[model samples]
Target: MRLRGVLLPAAVLSLTMLAALPLPSCIPQSTPPQPPPPAQPPPPLEVTNPILSGDFADPSVLRVGEDYWAAATSSEWAPHFPLLHSKDLLHWEVVGPIFQTAPTWSEGNYWAPELAQDKGRYFVFYTARQKGGPLCVAVATAAQPSGPYTDHGPLVCQELGSIDGALIRDENDTLYLVWKEDGNSRSLPTPIWAQPLSEDGTRLIGAPTQILMNDSPWEGQLVEGPHLIKRNGWFYMFYAGSACCGRDCNYAVGVARSRKLLGGWEKNPLNPIMKSNESWKCPGHGSVVTDTQGRDYFLYHAYRATDFVYVGRQGLLDEIQWAEDGWPTINGRRGPGGKVLAKPAAFSEDFTSSSLATGWVWPNGRQPTTSVEAGLLSLSPPADRAADPIGAVFARSTNAGNYTAETVLDVSGLPAGMAAGLSAFGDPENALGVYVRSGKVEVWHRERNTHEVLTSLDAPTSADGKLRLRMTAKDGQTYRFAVSPEDTTWTEVGPELSGAYLPPWDRGVRVALTAGGVAGASARFDSLRITPN
Candidate 1:
């Protein structure tokens, strides 16, 4: 199947505007109508199952002390990228975007972004289209690991068709970069190149020297997601190769090793250790990281096809072992699944009430418009910020299974056209949402960023407010939503919504309150709670 570039229509802005309206205070106290009591709380947020499935590709992860950070490629999607973090490898959260400011020039698309922590600062080196033409690496840095990152510099401009770039600082404080040049034709002719970095770890100091070229039949089709790792005195180059779509798109991981930063690298004798369908199918673009234990591990995404064509992916992990010749092998060729992987860390309940968890993202550049008070979160109308006015909250899919999110929203003070809602975001185009709007409630679905209003509710209110909402996700693609004001009255707003999973590279999901049109009315959220269902 061919992957298509998706654009969220401007029509969504009109919808947000049409729904934008100011809400009055609780129904007059003199005529206070007794509202129903609230429902009993759901179970605690526990990891009952896995969180991600289907097509989670080009994963890059960083382990900073007790914290782990990662980002992935979101090709053809605007604000195109995913940034994820974890305490333990199992639980992941969508923290924020690499570029929250209207992306300066991302005309072509964004591929894999390599995240690193140098000294005490966090940096992300990602590829985007330059203002004039071609792909280049834009660098953003922040004081904290999960950031409000600011772009400080740009590199690899001009004639290079760059993608999949990574940074590495050596023992003596030497910095180097390794990446693939896609050669303009969009084919696998792309070759991996490495160059030294300047003192401050910003720009390239010298010309990049070609280190590896695709020659294997398994790779002549394509070679992508180049990641570099230094261990045991060897510079290991990890990359993905072969076609990326269709049954024939044989994506798998390959490794090449060299003694110097730039060198005569040797391809692993046992190349393409991870394959799919023929074995697992479309299993490529793997990222390697060393856990706190100093044990090496590989994290990647792959497609597991069944009877028909279904677009879904599950995150996989495998321990790295040397083949006596110093080449890395995964789970002894049984792949990420056959191995008994060690769990990372667990998510904490003591999150800052105002700031999002370190790693998470919102679709179409949507952000929080409200303030946090007494543990209650409030949101302003969807103003023209990025693309979509509806904001969202997200966390990584810790595993591939079932999960749920619930929150208490006080929309009685909202405007007539305004809405208070919770959304499961994978990308701008792919997500599921349950919301209360225009005095009615509805379920929203999207393929890429295009949406379909699946269901609606007719719950009238005179204004003393609190809407209890819950969204249950069965794996990553299917979702179910329900709302209630009183404990005894529960309304199932809609059946499960259907969509594709956005990789950690593109973006994750978040809960948001939005106005359809230009009237930027605000909505209030009393208690925002999310747990694994």
Candidate 2:
């Protein structure tokens, strides 16, 4: 579960250094000391099947020269379309969000971001809901791969909704953007449409063409998430089908190929090339990235069967092997089986830094008023606290199936009726947590519009007025809450609670720091420690 470097002992290190040097030429000529064998290179790191640990669904990966970069669907969360970078594809570090905030024209509902590069410019073809319009495909450009990207606004907001904007180049080097018409929403047929992009790859210049549609029995009600890669003179388009979200999802990857960009594309007889196995379920909505050695790999998302859909659809990596027919197979067509995966190290964040970490997000892409100053994180009550959910909330995705999240909140300064606490939040509708008020601690659960206090007790703060809030979940379902004073002992605050009501069908639970109630009601948190069990 833990990874560490093997360090040589000091004596062994000194001897190894001595062996490498010229032996002074006088000490033993009769029996020349043999040079130590060349030090073996470190073994390659073994990354897990779900390469990204959290809710990184509908992942698109781009390999620009030597580095590998990825962007994922952010849904209603802010800092939409988080970009991650990796050197070996085994270890990934978050580069940052492509947009620091949502575009002025879009409100929320971000999904299916595609990462691409052309003409030395890095472009992100992403999906978002326009303010008063339907779901649309938008574009943003950055000079450097790790970006301060400039938003170009929505390109296509079809009557039925347009989503999953993928880019490709034809034999004539003409750029094109392909996306899905979201007819499945109204129980109509969905079509994959392609249109030529302007020189800048921004505007839809040419007339649109319907390249593919939902016609096969296996594809269910829709076909979407089209990505193109050319091999041996054929343009192979990889796409997904069926309900691609929630517990009812039956997603799978299918492929079609054409010699021409907009015509004569034929779906493979073995239409669905990738399907779920015992380990992971409903795998689809991914992109193909060829490595430095020209080996092709598929980066996609799948819900872990062990944790089911509770942890969200995590980003998974599978290799694409070309069969004798030039078609690709993922996981050797065995699915992303139960292979051993590496777990990231547990970390703690104290409010000593000036800026918040990259993962914190708010509901519907709207950030609440918050700040970190003088080694404390202060969350202010929202100006409009009329919403049914907690007034001001900041949260991070939990990657582990079982984990414990603890925060040290300086609750002494909180106003009456205004409480500071920790939460496992699925949306504005669903959450479970414990909060500290003036004279008592209350354990609350929110499902949809209903907010119920599960339990309450007259527990005051510590002598120093600090209270530690702790929330734990096991098997991604059962949850428990506890609170402690300055001491190490934790007192359970509520009955063992089930998290069945917390996770929505699409996203995972976010371990959050919450402040709610009337205006000027707030508290400062000193630190947050997340430990995976």
Using lDDT as the measure, which candidate wins?
A: 2
How many residue pairs clash (N, CA or C atoms closer than 3 angstroms) in each of the candidate models, in the order given?
Answer: 62, 0
lDDT of 2 by residue, 206-290 (tens): 7999999999988999999999988999999999988887778899999999998889999988768888888788999999998
RMSD of each: 27.7, 14.6
Over the stretch 1-533, how does candidate 1's per-residue lDDT look in tens digits?
11256554678656666678554586453566878899664432222112233334566788888888877665543344556778867666665556654466655456667787777878788877776788787677778767877776567764657777788764455887777787625543677777888766678887788888888887865677887887788888888887665434566788987777676688887888767643244666767877776667777766544311233344556667767777888756654454222232333322337664443333334544546666565556345532243543333333323455676677667677665677765555566687777778888876665767888878644334777777776644567788877535677887766644533333233333333422556666665554544
TM-score of 1: 0.69
- For each candidate in the order shown, give its overall lDDT on alpha carbons: 0.62, 0.84
Model 2: residues with Cα > 4 Å off, grouped in runs? 1-46, 342-344, 386-389
lDDT, model 2, position 318: 75
lDDT of candidate 1 at residue 496, scale 0 to 100: 62
Model 1 residue 386 CA deviation (Å) reads 12
Pairs with backbone N, CA or C atoms under 3 Å apart (clashes), candidate 2: none
